[model samples]
Target: MHIKEFFSPDHTRLSFEIFPPNQRMSLKAVMASAARMAAYEPDFMSVTFKADGSGGDQTIQISNAVSEVMGIPSIAHLTCSGIPKTELPAVYDELTENKVKNILVLGGDSTRELGEDAYLPYAKDMVAYFRERGDFTIGAACFPEGNDPALSMDEELRHLKEKVGMGVDFLTTQMFFDNEVFYRFLEKARTMGIDVPILAGIMPITSAGQVRRIKDLSDAALPDSLLRMVDRFKDDPDAMFDAGLTFAENQMADLVAAGVSGIHVYTMNKPAIPERIVRDLGRLFHA
Candidate 1:
């Protein structure tokens, strides 16, 4: 199903994300997890594009398994960074052949230097390119806290509007700890007239090391309360995992109450976390 059709103003949506497994052994484990996630029947599921060379083919294969085999709507992520401009058409062809209809276009890790011959320089161009091709429902990434430091907030909003104008069907946020940040972002996006449905991206922090990794990756400011929880449980893995899940549960509950378009769990390929969260939600949405 095209994800755009799922975004009705009358009901909130729920989705989960997982990545393509690189190894043959890991593929079995991930497929098992995918089946577990599918049992909950989220409105949709998304698979991330890996930077590894085979990410393109693997993305199509796994996405087909989830969508065609498991009977769930799936979104395949596409990244233009580090990949040759000439490679994407074949990737798109494979996805279409597999009947994958939803896509999330991303401007991958900024730290990775782009090659001189990269075709789609920005996510907007990628969105435009796929849009002109005309069959898929396209999604673009948004950072609720803000994106690259080099770009001012005004500049970022302008580019976001431009991307939507170029043909993004919806936006999914980068994972954030605070719901207020997402609300503020929504307000600003609406003020700027970029009105497509926005999905709240969430990651359940299940370990002490993940704290450092999130900080290193997104530079999102850790609130004092969250920091204190981290300090209190940092040494106990079991306790820390429980605390992290609690925090995510609370964050998601509040977002659901606020009526966000969708709650997208960055499951990190851990089916248990999303399974627990979905059970807690307990028929909150028609989806």
Candidate 2:
């Protein structure tokens, strides 16, 4: 099913983001994890693609399995930065063959140099390419906090508006800690006429190491409250895990109360994190 169909005035949808296994983990293990998460009955699950484009086949295989074998809808992430134009057809053919109809296009890490044959440099370009084909329900990423530190907020929203205008069916935000930041972003996006359904991405930071990694990878503002909690429990592994889960639960509860379109959890291949969330949120999902 197209992801857009999941949006409605009656209920807020839920989804999860997972990635392909790395060298250390076996494909069987990751598939087992996917099956466990699928048992939660999310609206859909998204499988991430490697930024370097080396794991596209694994991504396809997992997405196919999630949709075909697990009986759950899936969104396959496709990064355009490292994929050449010549190789695009094979990728499309594989997705078609697997009956994977949903995609989230991204202009992966900008630090990586684009190859000579790379034609799609930005997410907007990929949106246009898919718009012309009219075959998939396309999703693109947005940052409540601007993705590029160099660009002004006006510039960022203008670029987002242009991308959505090119026929993006929906949008998922970068994981954020502050709900107020997401609220402000929602207001600005609506004022700018970005009418598509937007899903708030939430990541449950389970360890002190994850806090450090999040700081290094994203420009998302870490709230003072979260910092304090992490700093207080930084040395205690078990306490840190509980604190992080509580923080995420409260964040999601607030988002749901405010009636956001949906919540997308970055599961990090750990079903227990989202399981805790679902258990906590309980009837809030239906209310």
Candidate No. with top lDDT: 2
For model 2 the local lDDT of residue 79 reads: 76
TM-score of each: 0.94, 0.95
Off by over 4 Å in 1: 23-25, 51-54, 110-114
Per-residue lDDT for 56-139 in model 2, tens only?
Answer: 568977999999999999999987775666778788888888998999998876434556456577888878887786589999
Superposed Cα deviation of residue 223, candidate 2 (Å)? 1.2
Give me candidate 2's TM-score against the actual structure.
0.95
lDDT of 1 by residue, 134-207 (tens): 59999999988788799887789999999999999999999999889889989999999999999999888887
Q: Report the alpha-carbon TM-score of model 1 versus the true structure.
A: 0.94
**Clash counts for all predictions:** 0, 0
